[model samples]
Target chain A: MVADSLVAVTIRSLVLIIVLLTVFAYLMLFERKFLGWFHLRLGPNRTGPWGLAQPIADGVKMIFKEDIIPRDADRFIFKLAPVISLFVAFAAFAVIPVGPPLKIGNWTVPLSIADPNAGVLVLLAFTSLGVYGIALGGWASQSKYSLLGALRSTAQMISYELTMGMSLVGVILLAGSLRLSDIVTAQESLWFIVRQPVGFILFFISVVAEVNRVPFDLPEAETELVAGYHTEYSGMRFAMFAIAEYVNMITVSSLVTLLYLGGWRGPAFLPPVVWFLLKVSFFVFLFIWMRATLPRLRYDRLMAFGWKVMLPVAFLNLVATAAWVAFR
Target chain B: MATRSPEYFTHQGYEVLETLDGDRMILSVGPHHPSTHGVLRLILELEGETVVRCTPEIGFLHTGIEKTAENLTWQQAITVIDRMDYLSPLSNNLGYVLAVEKLLGLEVPPRAVTVRLLLAELMRIASHLVWLGTTGLDLGVQSMIMYAFDLREGILDMFEEVSGARMNPSYFRVGGLAADLTPEFERMLRDWLQRFPKRYEELRALMEENPIFLDRVRGVGAISQEDAIAWGLTGPNLRATGVSYDVRKAFPYMGYETYDFEVPVGTAGDTYDRYMVRVLEMWESYKLVQQALERLPDGPWQTDDRKIVRPPKHEVRESMEQLIHHFKIVSYGFDVPAGEVYVPIESPRGEFGVYLVSNGTNKPWRVRVRPPSFYNVMAIPKMLEGNLIADLVSVVATVDPVFGEVDR
Candidate 1:
């Protein structure tokens, strides 16, 4: 009976994984379409009605693309890097609660794949591992730009990761729980964004830097470092890196919604999943809006900001939150 | 033996030369770089990250525009200027036409003057948007490009309403505008003017105080005011160095004096100062456009000179004389007196001057353009020396030289 239950749990987890991956693929298309609207241009409407098939086309193209490894590159590390990046990025979703539990006939299943007591810690570990892929990819390429980019990625990730981790301490303290679902429940009265605007801002900026998005994207500053760490990467291997980045964008956005905006909490009419998706979409749109509006920061400035500005702000927020929890 | 103690190396035909190991390294930046602002090449010698020497190689976008101008008549030459600094073609058109208008000795009506001022300011904002976006992109800010382009589209729409094209409007004729401003165009302009300042503030919030942006730009590519004047750098690039020199203020043309606006000057003349100057200038341009719109006088859009301008469209249908004049002007074009005139207009890049020798013919004998970007680009080497490889983009973006103008 125990073996049967274990098999059933594994099967249910596999189903959830498949569903999330499908959502991730469509989310990319959704971003492209929305960003296009924001820019007053049509994005991708050719493949199907409103470009529904565009992502599929992209996937097929990526699959058929010629995979090339640089001659002087460390073959083993280069091959392993993208896989590690993609695995870690996708694996983080397992801890995120997409919606409330659903019951059908005799079976009841949670929206998330797993709900561990240390869910937040597991997500952080996965994110930390993602940087290893970037560092390894840069080091393995053995090119100057790539090396510089990898070095930047290492420094940026280490610096911003601290702030990112620290910023979340406030959320953890408020919820008094590490599980994402439990945190969402705690936010039923009011969202963390209202109480901790500074932390939210810090978290948002650090994540943007961590993902190497615009303004903080020194690791892949195209004009200066010529694609930075990924200068030599090509074909589907490059596509995997690209996909992982978009996935991380989605993951971070979802996390922001859950932590600050009050996860899956909206007016009575909409379903819980719909509210979750709506909040996630809002954050995703913000990311695109920011990418389209601001200029990139210089490498020194980016490093300085991560160390000096974001770190201090995050620490202050953490202290304030701990004090508030104690006093309350 | 008589070789007398074998004289030192110098007397033995071996010359001693001094070598400095720490001399600046030579690096060629680009002909196809992302931040050269469109196909500009800069040869840089660096003492580590500081630029020791800079040499700008242009002519990539040169289509022999000056030579091409000589073949075309006064009116046809306007099209040629449109190709130079394609970002602010209206200003180019205004400069060329104003030069020809001076030769013809025609007075543009009040409406024409107002329209010219309005469009010129709009073009300045549009051009600066391109600068802001591309510069931001060069500095690794991907979103600034989108914001720049978004603002630019509204201005382009206004241009298209008046001139029927987004780029290369060629709307400004010799004595006046090609067409009157439509009612819809005016509404769009008023709406945009109101919204632009707020949007600019939003953009500033995103970038200006962000410590990273400040550090990258503040002290990089600093040029002294004396060196800037000596180098013949004009426009915002020159003004960034604390010089209060502006062609519009010093030598007013297109009735720029009538507008109430201030020329923003910077103290440091560094990359950051140049950026601040441009951003501040956009607001000034916004104010100018608003003033021009409010005080715009109603009158004939084009100059009333039958000898120069073609007769009205209504008269052409009935009067044989009008028909003949129109046919002659379109087919052979009008002639100017045998003399040379140099007319300069304040373009977004800088002072765009047109020197034309008419030779009492339909086509000019020789036409030359004093392009501002050419001079500005020459200052790159001086700017880059002793700066880091990363600071190269900052310097390039701050200069804001459009290759079309430089090459032309």
Candidate 2:
């Protein structure tokens, strides 16, 4: 019985990591293709049939490329930074279930790595820890551009995390559970986005910043800091940081899916995972579209927007949500 | 006199023991920065992300073109000057040629002047397209760089057909144009003129009123009219400051006085206003190019003088005087009888002036360029002060200082 449970958990964990890594690579391809269409130019199509193998080709190139470290870099921290980044990014997905729980005769298991009771807290904690990698990478680089990028990223992370937390509190108040599965379960009658439009918007924008995407991408503002915190990272080390970013994007999109878009929930005929994928893909596409359209926010204005605008709106939303839930 | 804050505790007047205020850090922003336009370094005194002092450090791209100009013949010098403001090579060519024309007291035929005007305006649009695209990239509109490049490629195709080189056409000669326009040039121009109005609208819609773009640009990097004038800001940058100083209006050249086009001006000298002024100026240039193409006169493409303009091919075959004139002009080059001339022309950037001194020789004794980007870049420190480091990118983009010209 113990052996059966252990095998089930190992198999599930392996499947989740491999599937997520594959998705991360394909998401990049999708972004490039989408951005190319937006710019009215051809995106990469040379690697394989329809450039389906472009990600593999890129991965090979990243692996073969010589890893470089700045001569004056803090070697220990510099080496650890990307490990930390990729680690936390993948760790956040442990609790994110892609489908409803499955039953195999007498044994029943949830389709997740670990469905912790405090899943939302775990997601928040891990997502926030991802910034430490960037901060440490920037500090370890021993360069001014990296330093500035790290500083901007840390400040932006701290600011937006407040708004992100407050915005989620509205959902927590309504759903009455910290567990992500519970939140998704609570949305059986209706998606949370319908009841919490303002919260959805606040969550979307704050998470955009948290994920270091454009319009909120001041931390790695290529024009200003060269490549920001990862300016000094090279080869697979750099690839790790990129992979971490994509994984975070996936994680955030899924979180949004579960919390607001009724994850794995749909009309009959289509499977639960399919529905989950479609919703998450839509969000990922929205992120890519935004990168194609919007200009980055200036650092001070981004901070001002986060604190002055998003935070206050989030607080008001929380109060309104509490009152409505109390009456119900 | 002290740069550090007064509240900091100091030991022995030199060493700081403890600090009461926030620590200030000096950041060096690039000789190889993505958005400095070229090799320009900035030393910034920063209080966290806010810049307290910004000092521009140039001269990394210094190639001594002015010194090299003294050795080259009057005609050969135009090719060298092509690289000064290489994005608008025709404007540099126009300025240098007009200066020599002033010294030689030569009359450029009406046809040549009209063609020059058409090409120069096209160059303005092309340069502005580049500015718009790169500025969008600087502010993190990821797709705009590709779009801008795509549009500019159309204009470059026209340039290549006329001069066989897209960037440094060097198509304008000392007395007139290097070559006559081919039938293909007209078709290219017609195609561009037809296609670009829609493209112009598309580019404008991409960011003009976009709230995020506006938030990044509007009311950022503002310069007062008085300060702008003091810094000698010119072209769209000068116009953005509400000064309304356009060289085309102040010192008319190439029959610009007759062209029916309004100089676009801005009320507030912010980055957004600067961007708007350039956009409006591109439209005005479009109108000018359209008018010039329609009213292009048919006559001699060069001045009818044997001294400055090259002799006709048939004449060189038949007449000894003509053969001698062609050979001398080809080898020793035509002399500009001793004189000093300064011709300030309206380049897309601003006032591009050529100061030339002649010693009655085939080569110029002195050739100095008054490139507008130089003065425009010098005003950056003022705009950058008290703004975040992120704002520096936009401010530099607004200044539009091409290092090739700034450090020329």
Candidate 3:
């Protein structure tokens, strides 16, 4: 019975991975379309009717493109870096609960790949691992801009991670569980966005920094650092890094929806999965909106903001949330 | 011997810690960089991220405009100027035409004066919009570029109605305008003026007070007033250093003294201050354009000088005298007296001056343009000294040098 359950879990995990990967592909299309609308231009419409096949075209192009390795590059590490990046990005989605449990005949599906006791901790660990890919890619390339980008990314991730982790502590304290599914259930009464507005603000900003979005994209600043850590990367390997970024965006948006915006607890007309997706899409829209609207932050100021401003605010929110939960 | 040398050095009170010696790293910053606005290359010497030296290498977009202008008549030179800035083509057209008008000693009617002012101000706003958008994009505010471009398209549409070209208008002539402003152009300008103030507020909300943007640009690339003047920087780049020196205010060319507008100045001559100055300048230009429209006079659009302006199409068919004058002007062009004249105008970039040396011929002996972009680009090396590589984008954007003008 235990072996059968294990097999079932593995299959469920594979299905979730495939679904998430498909969603990540479509999210790029969605962003391009939305940005095009905002700019009063048609985006990516020639690939298919309304550009439905655009992502497929892009994937095929990326696959067939010549994979270039720099002359002085550490070939082994360069090849391994993108894989590490993509692996960590895909792995983080394992703990994310997409919906409530499903029952079919005698078997039960928990709606997640894993409901590990330390799910939040696992997510954080995977995110940290993703940074290694960027750092390694930068270092292995043996280029100045790549090295600078790597240094910036390393410093940014380290500084912002503190605030990001602290910001999540407030949510964990409020939910009183490390599991994402438990956190989603905790939001059934009231969205944490309302109760812990400060935490939500901190988390949102830090995640933006973590994902290296505009205003926090100093590491990959095209003007100064060329294409940053991926300056020397080309072809399918570069595509993997790009896919990892969009996947990371999805992961953060999902986490934000689950923790703050009352995951899967919208009006009763929609199923729990639909509600969860709707919430995640809203956060995703916000992310793209910001990318379209805001400017990038400077490196020193970004560091200062992460350490001096966001860190303190996140810690205070955590302390306040714990106190509020203990009393109320 | 070592002890004796040390004793002498100690008595002299000369202490040497470390000798700075290394090959200065050479970095080519742009011909296709996001911050370059257009294709511009800055060869930088770096000691770490600090720029030790910078030399701007231009000529990437040299269209040989001066030689082209000589082949074309004085009336056709307006077209050549249009390509100089591209963003503020009308202003370029106006500057060139006004210079030729001065040489011809032709009196453009009051209506033409008012119309030229209106178009010039609109061009100013359009140019500033491009600057704001591209600068924001360079600084990582990708949205501002979209917003700025959106706003600029409205202005360009107005240009299209009057000049029939969105970019190279070539609408202004030596005597007056190529064509009168269409009724729809006025209506569009009025509508944009009414709605754009609110949109500016929205842009400000998105970026102005955002702590991240402020911290990135606030004190970075700071130049003192003295240094700004020494470097020969002008326009918003100079005005950012708290200087109230505007050619319009200082010299009062093209009936600018009559216009009611204030030159916005910034105390801190940093990237942020320059950005703010340009933003405020747009509002001022809007005010000037509106006033020009309200006070627009009813008169002939072009000068009455037969030697300069071609005879009307109807008159060319009817009168032999008109036919001869038109034929002479079109085929051979009109000649200026053997003399030289330097006419300076307050362009959106800076003081755009045209120096023409006429040697008793239709074609000019020498046509030298004192382009503002070249000088502005020259100041990059000075501004970038000791600044981090990250701040280079902000600094370069604030300078706002158009490559066509710089290369020319």
Candidate 2 TM-score, true structure as reference: 0.94
**DockQ of each model vs. true complex:** 0.27, 0.60, 0.43
In model 1, how well does chain A match by TM-score? 0.94
lDDT of 2 by residue, A184-235 (tens): 9999999999999999999999999999998788878899889999998889
lDDT of 3 by residue, B1-408 (tens): 011233343344434212324544556677876677788887665676677766676789999888888777666676786788877777777777777777767789998988888888888999998888888778777767888888888988988989889988887888888878888988898898888999888877777878867877888898889988998888999999999889889988769999899999999999989989998999999889889989999888988787877888999999999999999999888887777888888889988888887787887767788888888888887888888888889899889998888876
- TM-score per candidate, chains pooled: 0.80, 0.94, 0.91
Quick one: best TM-score, which candidate? 2
For model 1, residues B104-216, the per-residue Cα lDDT tens digits are: 88899989988998899999999999998887777756667787888889999999998898999889998688888999999899889888988899777767866667878
The chain B TM-scores of all candidates, as shown, are 0.93, 0.94, 0.92
TM-score of chain B of 1: 0.93
Interface RMSD of 3: 7.8
Let me know the DockQ for model 3.
0.43
Winner by DockQ: 2
lDDT of 2: 0.90
| lDDT tens per residue, model 2, B205-315 | 988868888888889899999999999999999899898888888889889999999998998999989999999999999999999999999888888788777899999
- Binned by DockQ into CAPRI classes (incorrect, acceptable, medium, high), candidate 2 is medium
Per-candidate clashes come to: 17, 0, 6
